[model samples]
Target: MKCIIGLGNPGKKYDRTRHNVGFMVIDELIQRHQWKLDKSKFKADYTIVQTENEKLMLVKPQTFMNLSGDAVRPLMDYYHIHLENILIIFDDLDLPIGKIRLRQKGGHGGHNGIRSIIEHVGSKDFKRVRIGIGRPDSSLSIIDYVLQTFPKRDTEEVMNSVNKAADACEAWVHKPFPEVMNEYNQ
Candidate 1:
């Protein structure tokens, strides 16, 4: 089995914020598959779908961003899914908007959500899909920038990245991570 885990804060308040791009990708994938993350357990909303020869699980943890591992670790354990079989998607501060990057393994790069997952999962060796949100402007605090929704000027770019991120996820479901990374991490 494979798992696609999107890291984001839970609630309507954070819905369209830069920090919730991960959730947006999950939503896009869910919509494409005509599925819903209706099951709530391990502090996550998830759904499982079986394809011709494999199964895939779409998950959005409800433990919020910083405590994401509180849900991810248990869910992986319960499902007997290997760390290599999972891909984590989250926002990145280093890349410009409209870009998506994929990595087979890496550090959290100061993201609390990735930090928590690395701590709980006990390794930096895992798949990741990062949606670039860029750094905050000089006037805005980092936290404030991430919590705020995209302005009108950025809406088109953000939506494009979200769509590509979702496509990358579906690619992972069908092929290996390296090939999917090469295809999407342009």
Candidate 2:
């Protein structure tokens, strides 16, 4: 079984904020495949979907961003999932808006959610799909910037990236991680 985890804060208040890009991508994938994410466990909302080749569990961590590992580690242990079988989707302020990047493994790079997951999992070798939210203006604090909602003018661009990130995820289900990275990391 493969697990795809989207990291973000839970609650309606964080919905559509830059920090919630991970949740947005997961929603896109669930909607596209007509899969329902109604199961609640391990501090997450998840659903299992079986394809001809694999059984996939799509998870949106409900423990919020900083404590995401609290949910992921337990879920993996219960499901007997290895680190390689996991892929995390989240937002990156370092990349420009509408851009996406895939990495086989790395440190959190200052992302609290990723840091938590790495700490709990004891490895930095899992795959990651980073959607760029872009940095805020110099005057704004990072915390406030990430929590801010995307402006109306940027909705189309953001959604386009979300769709592409969802597509990249689907491709990961069927192809090797390296191949998926090569295809989508343009």
lDDT, candidate 2, at 96: 89
**On residues 8-29, what C-alpha lDDT tens digit does candidate 1 reach at each position?**
9999999999999999999999
lDDT of 2 by residue, 1-186 (tens): 999998899999999999999999999989988999989998999998998899999999999799999999999999999999999999999998999999999999999999999999999999999999999878999999999999999899899999999999999999999999999989
Candidate 2 clashes between residue pairs 3 or more apart in a chain or in different chains: none
Q: How accurate is candidate 1 locally (lDDT)?
A: 0.92
Model 1 worst lDDT window (10 residues): 49-58
TM-score of each: 0.98, 0.98
* Residue runs of model 2 more than 4 Å from their true location after superposition: none
